[model samples]
Target: MSDTRNAPHVDMLRSPLGRVRGLGSAHRGAVTWWGHMLTSISLVPLTLWFIWSMVGLVGASREEVALWLTRPVPLALMLLLLVATFYHMKHGLETVVEDYVHAAAPKFALLLAIKGISILLGLLCIISVLRLGL
Candidate 1:
């Protein structure tokens, strides 16, 4: 039997330095929450404007449509919507890919491909909108 006074004691819950190292501050999750909120709020007005504009054009004549689209303000808004939509989509798809794709190489490749496709599609949409405006 060992003497109790000379025995080493281990506290399972506490370390000698007082706490575990490398465990960072707790607010990291809030960043993602805020990012989602910001993206959502931005999309709301853009989506409403796009839908309203389309509804207003439902029965417009070809020339009238052309004239409306060619205006600088609408054209600018369309461009902004195109960019914001693609950015939002990229963020969402990236999250999905990160969550579901377990393999490193395939995950990275898929993410890169998604980004490429989103950029290309956004550019194409901008060009098409511009051509219509022109």
Candidate 2:
């Protein structure tokens, strides 16, 4: 055991040049993080609107519900809700897969599936809403 307690931190072992050269965020992390944050923030109001609208339509007949959906504002908001929900879900699952799934092959497959399925579901929802509205 050394005395005087003057040991330098491990990070101090690297030169400034070495520190600068080391692997950083690769710049994509912030973009993904910000996207996740924005989607989540947008979801709050969108989700509330969806729930409230659905509550109002609870006792409505199929034709009545369809009639309500035909409105432009409701249709647009529904499309936005689907897009933001799927986008948010994709990013959340991707972060989980990246953090925990160390195997490269599985991680790649999961990420690809996440993106594909998110897009597919979002598009399907948009199409359904369009069919009802238009």
Model 1 spans with C-alpha error above 4 angstroms: 1-37, 59-62
Clashes of each: 0, 0
What is the C-alpha lDDT profile of model 2 across 1-134, one tens digit per residue?
66746875464544566456653343243456678889889999999999999999988998997899899899888888888898899988887898899999998999999999988988888888888899
Top-lDDT structure, candidate number? 2
Q: What does candidate 1's lDDT look like per residue over 1-73, in tens digits? A: 7678867876553343334352224313345545767778888998999999999999899888779879998
Model 2 worst lDDT window (10 residues): 22-31
How big is the RMSD of model 1? 12.0
TM-score for each candidate, following the candidate numbering: 0.66, 0.76
